[model samples]
Target: MKNKIIAEKSGVIDVVIIGAGAAGLSAALFLVRARRSTIIFDAGSKRISSSKNIHELLGFENKSPEEFHNLGEKEIVKYGGDIRKEKVLKIEAISNNLFAVQSTNSFVTAKTVVIATGLIDVIPEIPGLKEGWGKDIHVCPCFTGYELHNKKVVVFGLQDRIGQLSKFLTAWTNNVTVVTNQPFAPTWIKKLSAVDVQVINSEVASVIRSNGKLKGVITSDGQKISCDAIFVSTSMQASSNLASTLCKVDEFGFAETDAVGQTSRPGLWVIGNANDPIGHLAHAIASGTKVGPMVTDYLLEYSLADLIK
Candidate 1:
């Protein structure tokens, strides 16, 4: 659907949201309904766009992420929110309460800014892994565990996380295996054995697939282990430098915010994967919804102060 940009007389929006994902759209819905001039900049690279369907989100299970986002954008537009297809290039705090948001083609000023730009998952460099990603390859079973119930699942990747991840996978499958050369403490090994999860002390050299079906993974030692699916831990990387530039961020560039996504900068807020890398779809929606009133309040305060003056 084409966005109907609501022209503002002052040319300064009440809220400028730098994402069109679930979180950004949800916040736009609330703000637009509140009669705030909201503009959402959507670059359209949602983290879950690669997944065929979304899971763990009630009423949205098995639905395509694109469909969900389309519906969300429609709702926001219906409420008079402006949805821009451009990507925001930079955001500068012009005044204590105003921000200058520069996109590729144009720039806009906003009383408050919301950074909903999500994070990127740094998948390990393994052959054939990319081909089956979001299909037979997954990062967390929390989203697709039910589908793989009782199926053989191979776990590998980050040394600090694989042990726990393997154990976590046991919740949905008893046939779980961890392939990693990383040495685990005796207690950790015993714990995994207690849950009947197998551990192979070898690195995954590559993934094995046949006819678009994931067959298994090839270990570094030249042994192939058959599995229905593979789960690997990934390093989370911020998708945009906006968060680090505008607020206090970790080494990984994830913005550190208060419970409601309020960054160190007063008029700037970071939500969704921009702040919480491990957040799910539901969490993203909640974060967006949670930040809506705060942004509104910020704008309202500015209006009231100007009125007093």
Candidate 2:
């Protein structure tokens, strides 16, 4: 496919970016503004899809996730960048500083590549819990806490980070409960009791449901506690199996990136939740913006050296 003389033969684009979430769109905007030819390929499975509103996003407060993405798409097109609703199945470095991106439709080649594909949350196995996902069950307060203000909240603890996450959730809701299946609470969770958040150290047997809505959670001892919503502090794995197939991932399932988001392999870069330890929308946008100029600079340097040769 790389041998085919089509878009690459006509010099359609200089860089190809994967994922059209905040990170990918932000990078496309920056590159297009800098007069660099850029194309963005997006899969429809954005993490923000389930979110109602985004908070602390600077001038986009209380705006729906669709609203933010629409504005971003408009900005990218306004700067002469192209956005295609396609999923990238594979990415390979065909030559020095040249990459081939394969999708379901066609294959395209570019001088540089940026992968902003984010992560996925693996919720614990509990009955009726999956039904309430994104509606009454949430993972990030920055995306769902506004609607939960002053409401009864239950949080499932999967790690030590729950203590810190509980404090953040309290800013939007007063009534909060932390439940762990373990017999004893973690030391950090014990310390968090000083903050007035109730901690339950019992196994969750099931999630009680009524009329397709979350009513409460049942413990192994047959104790049912009523609550309005449940939050799961589960594990987050990077959505970078494609990237990992081509490169290497760290111990925590994050792609190892250089200062400019370049991976260990040439002609490949990654940003956003795929590489970030703390995956926030603001941080994702920042990482993409930072990588844009670096990619353009790399292309320019290579072009200049080629002319001298």
lDDT string for model 1 (1-309, tens) is 344555468888888999998788888888888888888898867899889999999999999998999999888888778788999999988865689999987799888999999988898788899888798999999999999999999999888998889999999999999998879988889999999999898999999888888999899899889999999898998899987767789999998899999999988999998888889989999999999999989887888988998
Q: Candidate 2 on 36-142: residue-level lDDT in tens?
A: 77878888888767766677788888788899999899888877777788888988777665777888676887888888888888778888877777778888787
TM-score of model number 2: 0.89
Please name the candidate that would achieve the greatest lDDT relative to the true structure. 1
Q: Point out the worst 10-residue segment of candidate 1 by lDDT.
A: 1-10
Q: What is the C-alpha RMSD of each candidate to the true structure, in Å?
A: 1.6, 3.7
Which residues of candidate 1, in runs, are more than 4 Å off? Answer: 1-8
Once superposed on the true structure, which residue ranges of model 2 sit more than 4 Å away at CA? 1-12, 183-190
The CA root-mean-square deviation of candidate 1, after full C-alpha superposition on the true structure, stands at 1.6
